[model samples]
Target: MHEGTALPGWTEMLVLAPLEWMELVGERLCVATCATVAYGAPSLGTPRPPAGMDYVRAYVLDSADTRELRALVEARIAGLADATGARELAGLTVRFRRLPPEDYASSWEKVWKPFRAGPFAVLRPSDRRALRATDVELRLEPGAVFGTGRHATTRLCLALLATRVARGERVLDAGTGTGLLAVAACKLGAGRALGFDIDPAAAPHALHLATQNGCADRTEWRTGGFEVLDAADAEFDGVLANIYSDILQAHAHELCERLRVGGWFVFSGVPDDHALATRAAFDAAGLRVETERTRGRWHAFAGRKPA
Candidate 1:
């Protein structure tokens, strides 16, 4: 738990692919692969991708099996490179670096230093200033979503919350990963912002984040799914969920139901490719899309409840 240096085997580079492709290959040599940033794959565009035909660099993980991973990449990904007969996606990248022993403590500490948004800054409270944003700040230990401000989903949610947060509006955050968005809601103007997640470990960090932002009393976070939430029976002015499309789609009806009549709903963490599927689910649930924004491979779609 003490500070340490990062590792030295992780690889990183950009990967360009056709806009039509879905779910490319990743390494099996490692237990998990995190997407540092996959840039330049927006869902909507008429301008063709570059014909240079080579992605600049790609970050990949192999853990102790770097050699095997390289071999697999050569046989599979390299072959795809050869098949670049199509030319629509050519500037994707994931700048990755292996975790050094101290990487967990140092680099993130450095990374969090520049997180500035509206009135929000993410910091350790103990540290001088790990994250510096707007008036309301959120402190996180840097877990699932990395330093917290770099994901497409996070950006999209922040934009939506900043726009509509109003005095006395009750807010609910579904699948509140890292608790960044929920903290944001408090600063943006929601009288109360409650967050829900199935992972119990997330509660403490979320609690700390809310406390750091001075929204601890108004912001309540707990461990449970929609089932537990269903019992509350109270409606909210807005609901924000930045989770996988599949899960969101499953809870479409319930998510829509949690909203007060004529209220707002903001959702993100959806890959660009899955927008259509999400749209379909929302449509099926009697929701109407009010605004949509996309960046790289991520998208945010907001809907209104017949207001």
Candidate 2:
């Protein structure tokens, strides 16, 4: 799902399973097809499933391997049913159909409207809505990469960045999916911003976003992890990370060391179950947690390096 790519024809895989097994079936389907799975939900005009049965669907490119992939999906489902003793799954089968191609390029433009994150107004590339005089508008194309400012964690980070970023300060965005935070930092008056992610596809998408937001001159994107910033003397006035809790804990020290004394940081994507441990890791890294925000089951933290 890279940016600016045409929507190719797809082979849709649909399965009907009991409500209790839908999630499990979806997970196995994702593992089998290496693609996103969609669980059916009743729409306003759509009828609900029969009793406890629900529909799970996944898609694959309509290519020569479609038949082979279908076989693999069925085998995986059978294996999962056997392991869990779910007899219903063993008897279930995948219904494959070819999806007609349409103008998906403009599909998002029709559905994705402008949204706000603190003082910033997040909009898609095609959105041309008017805004307030003080609005800091960010034009972005999510393109399969993360951080559209719609997620709780991303919004939390944006709010923190609005309050913490200072004029002319250098900022670092680790795991900078879509480079949303880095672009936001530049718009917030940061003198410079550096962003890096492990996914090679992230760099181009992020760069495009930075350019679209008119912050390309102030931001740099790389296609690697923390190792990309290997310079020993490299330091930033602010750091942002919206990554998993376990990865945050593992690299807490490295991330903290890259921030100058008295520098600020916003860490997010920590589930409630891992909030306490993540906070402990931040503390161990000498980051004094000054603000904590919780939305739904996720937590985000704003803090600074102690002298």
Question: After superposition on all CA atoms, what RMSD does each candidate show versus the true structure?
Answer: 7.0, 5.3
lDDT, candidate 1, 1-307, per-residue tens: 4436335444553345544442342221122343443334322442445654322333445453365555554455545434544333233333334433334324544444445454555456665644433355555566543226656577777777777778878999988866888888887778988888887756776887778778888888888888768567489999999877888899999888888778888887677657899988988887777999886677888878885
Writing each residue's lDDT as its tens digit, candidate 2 over 6-75 gives: 6677666778878767756766676443545556742245467788888887766666336667788888
Candidate number achieving the greatest lDDT relative to the actual structure:
2
Clashes of each: 33, 0
What lDDT, from 0 to 1, does candidate 1 have? 0.65
* lDDT of each candidate versus the true structure: 0.65, 0.82
Error of 2 at 298 (Å): 1.3
Error of 1 at 269 (Å): 1.5
TM-score for candidate 1, residues paired by index: 0.69
Tell me the TM-score of each prediction against the true structure: 0.69, 0.75
Candidate 2's C-alpha runs over 4 A off are 1-106
